[model samples]
Target: MCGIVTAISTDNVVPVLLEGLRKLEYRGYDSAGLAVLHEDSLVRVRSAGRVAELATMAASRHLTGNIGIAHTRWATHGEPSERNAHPHVSAGLAVVHNGIIENYEAIRERLTAKGFVFESETDTETIAHLVRDKLNAGQPLLEAVRLTANELEGAYAIGVISEADPFTAVVARKGSPLLLGVGERGIYAASDTSALLQVTRKVVYLEDGDVAELKLTGYRIFRPDGSPVERTVTVSSLSADAVELGQYRHYMQKEIFEQPQALGNTLEMIAGGNTISPQVFGAHAGDVLGATRRVLIIACGTSFHAGLVARYWLESIAGIPCAVEIASEYRYRVSVADPETLVVVISQSGETADTLAALKHAKQLGMDKTLAICNVPESAIVRETALRFITRAGPEIGVASTKAFTTQLAALALLTLALAKINDRLTADDENTYLTALRHLPVAVTKVLELEPEIEQWAQRFASKQHALFLGRGRHWPIAMEGALKLKEISYIHAESYAAGELKHGPLALVDRDMPVIAVAPADELLEKLKSNLQEVRARGGELYVFADAGSEIPESDGVHILHMPEHYGMLSPVLHVIPLQLLSYHAALVKGTDVDKPRNLAKSVTVE
Candidate 1:
């Protein structure tokens, strides 16, 4: 994922763009660049590291302009290098882009045949040349951008500025996120509102197939066919304090502890008294519930895990036949879909590339009842779908998601209850019980956080291990997968998760004394079966760290350490059990000397494929 910011102002815009880039750097940090229209020409500066290096280079020389575009890149088409960085320029136009261009190779070859030279291996460089070619053919700047956008064949949010039109900037989006911030003197465009939060509170989220022309006065939106479209500017309530970690040592830890409050706020909005608002479900929920014949859940990464859990809840509680698919693979397979099918896409960042693609693909297949469960209120995914439910997890700074994942689960649980109520599947007693359980969740989460000290003590025993295994059954199986993912993502340890019953199939052979086995042993109907699975690992001489419910009998073994968590109500245990896993991974990564906030080769948001 890359970050892009552009400003059209009366004063010089380089300093403002640099500030915006610093705020947006969490999206991507491979390289950074800025291009400004200066003295009837385009001036460009770029570097191959973090934004600090680029700022140093920019400080060495004076590059003055009132309008410009900047980028912090996460390389996709080429390796991270100075030449491969963004702000790709040709003649008078300078461009910065986020997302991939699927047809760049074909377009590059055609341009090469026309005797046009290339500068770098980035797919974005091809856009600059295409715009220059259009201008060379006697097209105006707006027409050139329109033609170039029409020819591109993949996800992108591109910002374009030209010396020929120094007072204006143009932006277009297909799959990635882009927002226009309305201000008094000028307008701002960025990949996310975080970049513009300091300057303006009002924003217009650009829709797919929409083009924005930013000028000194204001910006204009147009359809793909050049038809004017009017949009309302919504004011954002996100403050600067929300993005800060406050007094916490790490963002992951802060986010982990914020779960209880975030869930409480979400529940207050949905289940508060006298509020029977279906609009909270989304604008198209009525149409979707009435016309839907089946349901499909699509997502990637942690959101995929949430969807997997939702599948169980939806099928068992709501009596809806549901199927869950990883968004990356969903589009490749030929599946049955129609106007009656409701496709639900889940993602923390609505700009997740694969999920957005899956959403568009579902729409193309005539699945009009598309709903998105996302954290960002005005993300590209929210704009593309007719229905959306925004998670109240303010802003997750850690590269590995903590609060977002849990908040998504909480939201999905609400959706399940809503479905049950609408379908007459839940009686008054059942509804009251579910709501009561939900209201007590924040307190249960607080009790779960008390297990941190014990988890940290257990983490020390496995800090030197080369590999690990996690096991669970039923709903906890997804939690097992998520636990293993968090460990591998941050600790750089080889970890694999398996269903407790499936351990003997082939994964058990890899277990040894040097390998750590983390078992989720919450007290449930399948507790005895899970205990037998734990015995199998013990027999294999696997170093065991079991997270069990309070008062549960964890058999004494020489190398086994039992972490007794507070007893939680059934179906609410997953939320409690996840706390220990998070603490284990966090402490393990801290001991291993890994960056807890910014993991390697990963960004906070996956806006590009």
Candidate 2:
């Protein structure tokens, strides 16, 4: 969850490093710092706060150089403090790292025994010591980093610079994301493309275990074995304005409003089409879908909730058996391997560490038929999968996902239709009907976004509450889970979700005047049963907030509050039902005066376990 930006330039790079760190704020960092080679001497500045604070510190200290490395760290091994900040230096070698070094303790002991002192309690410090140790052995900058990387045993994206080698900075990635930025002024390295979009649109996304050495004029890539390699440089499609807040107060709010467009973009290929084609997924999707007898969906967080919804769609619509697994637990537990199962891995960033590991685990189990539904193109998960669907959610900057989740649902829906067609479960009329619904889905979400003003009123009430219980039935049960997640993520509220029928089991006890019970009351077949569950909540003296379909006839009563959706979208209703919940969370966080974009203890991309 940390960020790294390294540059070797012909001019002062403090501004570039600082601005790059600011761009990576969405990745969620508690500490910021930079180390530069000024006059062939290592000069470092750090702050246990925002990039702005680091910028101020750098300015006050007149920190300027032609070559440098910067970091925005989300604490892992150490607490958020100046002493624990990155740009960990040893023997004139500076290193900033993004992922965990699993064997840091043993390495730390070895280094300590060898009389190498550590000033910071970070796994990153071990890398600096190791690299500096290689330098002490008379290795060059690139060789030193490559030798140190060989000793590392966990995921990491690291940037290293040495005062003795002022002309170069070496960056490497193994099980984490790292890229090289090419520009006229300098050569750069960043953990994310967004960080270097300002410096250069052309970037070489380094493969796992690839290392790069950056100089003012050019860069060179090497494999883990120190063999030379070449990576393709591609232009990024993301604009600087794509990440801007624009007129919105926060990125979360902006992303919430962007859902309709995101969904439209994700499903754009199906427009004006009467049939749902398997080719929409990939070139071999037809063969894969035709052969898939069972589906196993793997993901984490919001993507996991999306998978839960997909399970219902895959089974009920396609008449195929489906199961959803939390990626972290799936890999650790032993399970029966089914060769007929189509393993679907979903992630917004596509770099989720657990999900990727789980995919590898499934592969190890001989489940070779793999698919990835993700937002970022060319992500590790996408590359690992045999089939892929790239959601055009653009860039989701908020730590709490909005557009990405909805876009994933859109992609999953397409997959469902494709599979249903492949199995002959979907007739021509059925395909047309679902296609029309899919085309109209954006408009439906736009209408839901219009309910934000009304939802804000509900959020104002929610902000004062310490707990919430969300209830939904059938396919919408997962929507309830997602709503509760959004509330817990941004609003600092403890929220729980249950399938409406499960309320009587134990969650009903949590229902009271102080605990808000939010219900997703769509006009599906389970409407009456969900209403019965709501009645139970009302009987318990619980405050109720309901988002219902317009024609559901769930009237506003003394203790019940209702916001009717503009339409009932049948199987696609979960996609619409989630919009108001996102707004509710965003507004609740806003009313609570919390950080709406970067929630505490959360990062946009979970690159580490």
Question: What is the C-alpha local distance difference test score of each model?
Answer: 0.85, 0.92
Residue 45 lDDT, candidate 2, scale 0-100: 95
How displaced is residue 345 in candidate 1, in Å? 1.6
lDDT for each residue of candidate 1 in 23-76, tens digit (9 for 90 to 100):
887664789999988886888999998888888888888777889999998889
Error of 2 at 323 (Å): 0.7
Which residue runs of candidate 2 sit more than 4 Å off their true CA positions?
A: none
The alpha-carbon deviation from the true structure for residue 255 of candidate 2, after best TM-score superposition, in angstroms, is 0.7
Name the top TM-score candidate: 2
| Per-residue C-alpha lDDT of model 2 across residues 400-451, encoded as one tens digit per residue | 9999999999999999999898888999998999999999988988888888
Q: Candidate 1: misplaced stretches above 4 Å?
A: 62-64, 270-280, 283-294, 338-341
